[model samples]
Target: MKAYFTYSCILLVFVLQACQSNRKTETKNGGIVKYKITGKVDFNDGMQVYLQNYDNELQQFQKTTVKDGEFILEGELVSDGIYNLIVKTDYKDKDTGKKSFRITYPVFLENNCDYEFKVQKYRDGNVIQAAEIITNSEASNNLFVFEKEVAKVKQTWDTRREALSNEAAQLKASLMTIGKGEDSKYNYAIDRMREAGKESQELAKKNPREEVSSLFVNKPEHRTSLITPYLFKYITINENNYARYWTVLDSLDASIQQHPLTIAAKAKVERVKNFYEQMPVFPSITPRNIKGDSLDISKFRDSKLLIIALWSSRDRFSKMDIPTLLNKEPQLKNLGVSVIYLSVEKKFEEWETGNKSLGLGLNSYLLNVTDKDFIVNNYNVSSFPTYIWVEPKSLKIKELRGGDPATPDFLSAIKKAL
Candidate 1:
């Protein structure tokens, strides 16, 4: 069986905001799998329907139109898993000539599966209503039963998803518009943000995989919407982290450090307020690739900036942080910074699996177990997913993530270097 992987996972963990990791649909021997879904809706003709999967991303599977209260959706299941079954239509009333209405349901799917869904006709003031979806797939049927059982229970984050996501988007918008509100660029940015916010809210209801959003969504939140404050803290604090409290703390922007939500995150770390003013010289060492081939750091000295990310597959932060950084690869490349992932996993088998599972292990390599002690000691590698920014020529090393936010991060350092 071949299982393609998505960066989002269906686990009880979240990324910076809500993204996580998950594996994509699978097929045996890479053979194509098709799915057919026929359904009846109480909704009138011209109704619109869509199928999508939420994995920190709203992945559109298929889109079709409804005719005369019935619809048919048949497509190649790029991979088999649960997807969001969305129903939308336009209604007209005396008060308003036309209004739009939409609702979503979670549906389970697999290869060669035939499913049926019925949206019983009912209306409240031009608004169609359906309490639960009627489906044919047993897995989907069981899921509907589970959703009904928990229908009345509202999670704390369930209410907070919209608010926090809004706040985060607003904060980002404020950052870009701080002194450029009158600029056309700022205006365009705000418009896009509004669209993203609206999409995020809708995905939150439709995606059962996690907290889905249109804008910058996090993983755990994407795979599963169970991102309570407690879980947030647990994902960040419960891991085997070894970096200094001040290291990450100082790396954040002054504004972010003081943000109301981040203030709580700030309280957990220990920091050395004033560390060395200069970047420390990196200790020379040999690195190895995934196939246990040797590497010479000298060959990379000509590169403007190099990032050696030390992480482990078993670490939670690695699972989340790796994907996030990889997503920013284009920006990093524009700055002439090259990234190398060095896994310190105990077993090579697990390292290989983790690399595939995370799906962002493009330039990943394995740290020599025999060389672990010396590297760990000199590099200040006390945590999982530590990024070491090296100026190979000068051999100066700056640990990234949380620093002075002035020149500690890769972007800032690249700017200063250039």
Candidate 2:
């Protein structure tokens, strides 16, 4: 695909920006600051720019259209808030003669700020990634700097993953060409990638045994853990966002740091961090398998992640990811992950029938009624079909988050290693 824009124009695809309001209003906080957002663009004319807040909702001040080369936007912010100025380029493909994409970005905003939004990098055909966004506001600029720093870490993580995957691929290909068996290097690379959260996308899709423990992640969307410039707002990337937020909060000006929102956010981040850090290891369960064999969940004394799936036969959605897990058992094993399917059914007979009817497999078991309270309380199993990710080594809890996991908020907590 062709590139979206030239290098000179700045792209403002910020991962997060708060409170970009076109309304000229005052706040109870006292100071009413206005924003002067001006920048050069790659377009010629009839380009549209819209305002969006951290919520991902398009709260448009107006349907704005401007000439491509240079543009200026004016807005009032009562305080520092998250928002984005999304630019939908009137662009066309010269080669394919096709109209490409309408692009938008998430950028932060501050009252009384002068922001220079420039075109940066292109993530794909549709999304334009601004290499840099400069602002006069200290608080806002701090966030930009902080985001860049955090993005670097995220990028480094992905790059290492890519490199490991590539090296593993090269080794495997060389072995194949020579008609030889697997070697230590291949196993080492695979283990490293597993530690890094995922393996090579091509390999994962090609062999079920090579896929991530998440299972059935064949789509391209599953490949990208996303670069720094992503879909993030006040809460950046689940657990990642809070750490960065805390880091920036420490560096902000005293008054800005003391701002009501900042205070609340700081408190929340601290609370969350403390809660997770203090989260006790998952209590072990020794339930009977569908095979009528005794099983103890705490036997794995190594670095293999445990994906404990809690579901009921009555709740259809509860067993949704089960078949995929079963079919991709090899894949899970490769990733050093184990699946423990515990049905939260009331009757033992119901679990027996459900397992046969649904073919829940040997890994599936009915949570003993006596053990139900123990499992439910420890795992925090509220809903019917919940997948609890228990961390390896520490045996701490890492649950599926991100409100839908598909959304910006999904295991998201799995940012924690298995």
Candidate 3:
């Protein structure tokens, strides 16, 4: 009897150990996410909600159905990441008939946990009146709250901008006709615009160490103009600032750093490093002309200044920019600057056609390299219609412009380089 009792006790211990192992395995795999939408529910059963992995290169999407105003999503995330929950619905408008709309909510997700979201729809059926995360994770909740606050700040700035714009238009008309009475109003609008900029700067500085700070770093829409200067000032490559910037980046959730939205921020950090560490010389490569003759960029070292314009024919911005560069050539030539348009188009025929269509009078070359990564890495070219101004004697990149050439910012960079 004693032997049987001792064997039974040992078996029970083994069973408990097996259960603990299973639980650990499950935790290591992934977690569950439960989402519930409340308020006006006009949609039918089995309406689809998409879960998109936000940081992934493949942009993996998973779909679930809303049954009784709720859906569950389960997955294994190797690392914490930002995921998007998207819902599509259609409604009939009183005036315009039926229209379809999409609602997207971003959530920061981690493994081995469950997250719940409750979102409300407004009477308009198109607007999300409010959204709240019922999850226990404070970091995830804080990110969402911070995003909402940023949205509010942006809205206020936009309102002020519109008012100032309208007043300035009226003031311009007044100046053309009378030119005296509305000057104070115009000046007041200008002052308000400057005030709005300061407010944006202050909002960004509020949480420099948080993941939300990445939002302010390099917003593509305002990259070359509004945000770039702020980033340059804030993330300077000095010893103390560099260490602080790295610390902030390291502190972010691993997935956020890899997110598409944060690519600009990462690139900015790398740019700071490159400026301090990397060689200042441009790469030497000989590309072919329309006639298939090699035109060595190194040969242009004798010129006082060399302007290399990297563009693709398919890009809408390039269509506008190529002509602008051609038009400015005479002025550029007078200033001892020579312009070269290098086509990065995939096909030689396309390059030929685009070059002919542009009616380019300045030097032109077709990038003949089969390895696309070489050009991208060497030039640090992220987008098309990129202008790189080289000081030929040293091949040092004196100025780099990635935004619209028509902007005063780009013009100023060009002037400074000259």
The prediction achieving the highest TM-score against the true structure is: 2
By lDDT, the better pick of 1 and 3 is 3
The alpha-carbon lDDT assigned to residue 301 of candidate 3 equals 70
Which residues of candidate 1, in runs, are more than 4 Å off? 1-31, 56-59, 91-99, 145-373, 377-418
Alpha carbon deviation, residue 61, candidate 2 (Å): 3.1
For each candidate, what is the lDDT? 0.57, 0.56, 0.60
lDDT-sorted candidate list, best first: 3, 1, 2
Query: Roughly what TM-score does model 1 have, to 2 decimal places?
Result: 0.34
- Give the range where candidate 2 is weakest over 10 consecutive residues by summed lDDT: 222-231
Tell me the alpha-carbon RMSD of every candidate.
21.0, 13.7, 12.5
Show model 3 residue runs off by greater than 4 Å.
Answer: 1-45, 53-60, 77-79, 90-101, 120-128, 179-244, 250-268, 280-410, 415-418
281-307, model 2: which lDDT tens digit per residue? 666667787778766775665647777
lDDT of 1 by residue, 1-418 (tens): 1232333442323552232122121112222457777877654577777887744335787788878878898788654345687777766554654457887877766443457766555665435576455543334554564455344233543665666576657757676545744666666666767766766665465533222111111322222211111112332331133143334434543323333224443454322222233334665666656665666767777778777777888899888778777776688778777777778888889988998887854377777766666568755678887777776687665444322222336455456545
By summed lDDT, which 10 consecutive residues of candidate 3 come out lowest? Answer: 221-230
Per-model TM-score, in order, reads 0.34, 0.50, 0.45
Clash pairs, model 3 backbone: none
Give the best candidate by lDDT.
3
lDDT per residue, candidate 3, 1-418, as tens digits?
Answer: 9999999999999997876444323322223443332322344344556667654525756676667766666655444445776766554545744345666777666543346656654445434455555654433555565567667766665676576566656655654554467778667666665665556545544443233345544333332121222233334444235555654554444334443334555566666556645634666767768777777776667777888889888998899878887887787677777777888888988888898999863378877665345657866788888887777877777555533556656544456455
